[model samples]
Target: MYIIQKLINRFFVKNKLGIFSFTFFIVIFSSVVMQILEPKTFPRWFDALWYVMTTVTTVGYGDFYPVTVAGRMYAIFIFLVGIGIAGLAIGKLVEAMGAHRKRKEEGRLTFKGKNHFVIIGWSEKAKYAINEITETHPNLEVVLIDRLPVTPITHQNVHYIQGDPSIESTLIQANIEEAQSVLVFSDDSIHDSALADGKTLLIVTSVERLTPHIHSTVEIKREEHIKNFRHAKVDEFVLSHETVSRMAVRSAFSKGITGIYTQLLSHKEGENLFEVQKKAEWRTYKDAFDGLLEQGATLIADGNDLSINKKLNEAIPEDARLYIICSKDVYEALA
Candidate 1:
């Protein structure tokens, strides 16, 4: 009952289109019912409906006419009510169509797909992430949600929807439920990192509320908030500042460290981390590493099970299930 009342309020009170539609339906119904009751005195019900339409439109096709006094009175009343209703209906229809077109033009439309990536926020990190994601998953579609306007990317795989990512409406627009994963990035302003973090947390909370099982990664600038974010159950957190500081320290200590790191980060020529399924036919770390080297890709580390067999290197286990660092060409060939 409450829902019905809410709907009535929305249709009759909130939107003029709904009111106009209701009026149009009433006019049509009354004209049909009246004609049916006095069909002998008047023409056919369809003929009467047509007469009402033409009368409202001022077309006045003389083919159908009313002979009885009662029919004429009814026709006069219909002409008056139908003309107003028809005019309002046409106006409302035009308005609704215009709004829909505007939303589409502004890239505020919803999309749904499985295995798609949902990107929340439009910072520089997001740009970098998109570049990396496209190289890795060329066929994967990316859905971006932000408050600002949606800009077109050179890559056809990226899609944009404009809205506050913290809002459920925006997440729905990006099809959060069907997405394989979501990457929430920081806002553009450099000084507003905490503010961005708060916004991101809200978005994370909202996503969890709607879909508790969704996989999500968030960017955190400060180490202090890591615990709080972890408590929120975020799947992954990328410490951008920490990574940059590590690179800076490495560069300071070694002459070619920056260049080597750049190559490692890139997918083209240097070592890039890739996750691949281990077949039952192939077992043991030594065998897998040797096979990957033969395939023109060097094995770095494993991703699945991080625990290492301590004999070779305490940091890296020989029996670990995940491996990192490989060339794109080699990874694709193996895949």
Candidate 2:
């Protein structure tokens, strides 16, 4: 048994397509040999082929059998070789599938998609962002690039590539050029805020260098690293410490503000921020605001500038996009 296993392994290693091709050849050869030896039993080529298949698979029905001595001797040879070849073919196919799965889990597989979200880094914040996006936009495709050995988040729409996010090759594997936006996260495992921010800046710079057109949001642990990211032309920056500190202070001063913010950010409950393109007939901010209100939405901003109550009289640009606070159902209803 050991000798046979070793020989099969050696044969597969020497010839990349050996197992499958050899199995196919054995099936054909056995069929032909059976037709020649059992001419009386199976006069037709199709009947001989059927007999070979059933016998090799160990599903022999009593109807088909080798009546002559020469045919019986050939049948013994066919059973040993044919069954071994079929087993080897099945084992090889299973091994290939397992290898492919391992490569995917290890982030070695290439991603192919457009308008997908590319998340650079693996941390608690990154994991939360992935889950939130997948849950909120179930159809949106997300590719995660990190230096971890395996993917931390498991979702059907999420593809993971395990490598340094700062590396251009890794971003290419994630298909950065086809991505609509990227989110660069700081390494939370790194205790030094400066070092973590430095790593994040490298990833942001790499992303910008590869695809300058794609929008990117970067997370900065220290305020000092903001300038570095700005130089990289990052679309937006999230200061974790600053935001948390302010939220904590605000929560202390006014109770329920934090809970309100959480509810607004969550996709499952309350209304969240959404952006919609301005219509041609909407001449002013007030017109767009009223239109959205009719659809159960409240216009909060015009592009990056907050509209709220100040820009009511301002002329809405034809190409302007309006940010509104609304639920997913409400936003889709307007669509």
Candidate 3:
């Protein structure tokens, strides 16, 4: 028993490929031997091959058999060898597939999807961001890249690639060039705020260097890092500490303001902010606002300018992008 276990470990566990190759060779050799030994039963090499395949897989059809004494003895030998080889081959195949899946779950596999969202770094905020995006945009793929060995989020549309997001090769593994957008989260585990922001800046710089036109949003702990990110042409910057502090201050003075902000930010329940392209029919802010209002959407802004108290009669430029507050269903309907 000990000797058998040792052989199994050596050939099946440690050398799976070698055992698979040996099994394949045995199958071919068995087919040829069966053809030569039992010419009467198996008139052609094709018939012998078919019989060998069925017998090895333990799916014997019983359509052919060895009639002569010598053929019968050879048949018994072939049966024993074929069954062992087939069992080992099947076991090894299953083991290999399981290992591959384990590697993938560990975020060691390369992602191949295009037009996907690439999220860099991991934190509670990053996890929430992934949940919101995946929940809101079910069809869009999201790839999470981090230096951690395990995936932070598991979703059908999400793929994990474990690596340093600042590395060019890591970005390539995530297929950053073909990605729709990227979000860089500051490393919260880093004790030093400066170091955390610096890491995020490095990732942002790397992403911009690879794809200048791709939209990118980054989180930074310090306001001083804003200029560095602006130089990188980051589309947006989420100043974590500053933004939360301001929100907290406002919520203290105005009760339920935070609730309103939460509803506007959440994509799951209440209406959320979304941007829609300008249309020809809406020539002015009033025109666009009325059109959106008709569809149950409230126009919030035009480009970076607020539309709340603006002159409605002012002509909206051709390139103006309209931002609106509406439910997901309403936004989809209007869009």
Q: Please, what is the whole-model Cα lDDT of each candidate in the order they appear? A: 0.74, 0.86, 0.87
Mind giving the per-residue lDDT tens digits that candidate 3 earns over 27-72?
8898898889889898999898888888888998999877888778
**Model 3: how far is 327 from its true place, Å?**
1.8
- After TM-score superposition, what is the CA distance of residue 88 in candidate 3 from its true location, in Å? 2.4
Encode model 1's per-residue lDDT on 1-335: one tens digit a residue: 99999986777656886777777686678668668756874466777677666777678887666677776777777777767666666767788899986775466777867789988887777888899889867898988777776454546787788887778888888888888899888665756778767777888889877777888898887778888788888888888788799889988888788877777777765677777767554456656666677888666557644443432233333445556457777677888
Strongest candidate by lDDT: 3
- Which model, 2 or 3, shows the larger lDDT? 3
Query: How many residue pairs in model 1 have overlapping backbones?
Result: 10
RMSD of each: 8.6, 3.3, 4.1
- The per-residue C-alpha lDDT of model 3 at residue 175 equals 92
Best by TM-score: 2
TM-score of each candidate? 0.63, 0.86, 0.83
Q: Candidate 2 lDDT, tens digit per residue, 1-335?
A: 99997886788644548878988888888889888988989889888888888877778886778898988998889888888777777777888899999999999999988999999888889889998998878899999988788888778999999988888888899999999999988888899998888888888888999999999999999887788888889989999989999999999999989987886778877778888877877888889889988888999887778745997888987778788888888888876
Candidate 3 residue-wise lDDT at 297: 91
Q: List the pairs of residues colliding in candidate 2.
A: none
Q: Arrange candidates by lDDT, descending.
A: 3, 2, 1
Per-candidate total of colliding backbone pairs:
10, 0, 0
lDDT of 3 at 32: 91
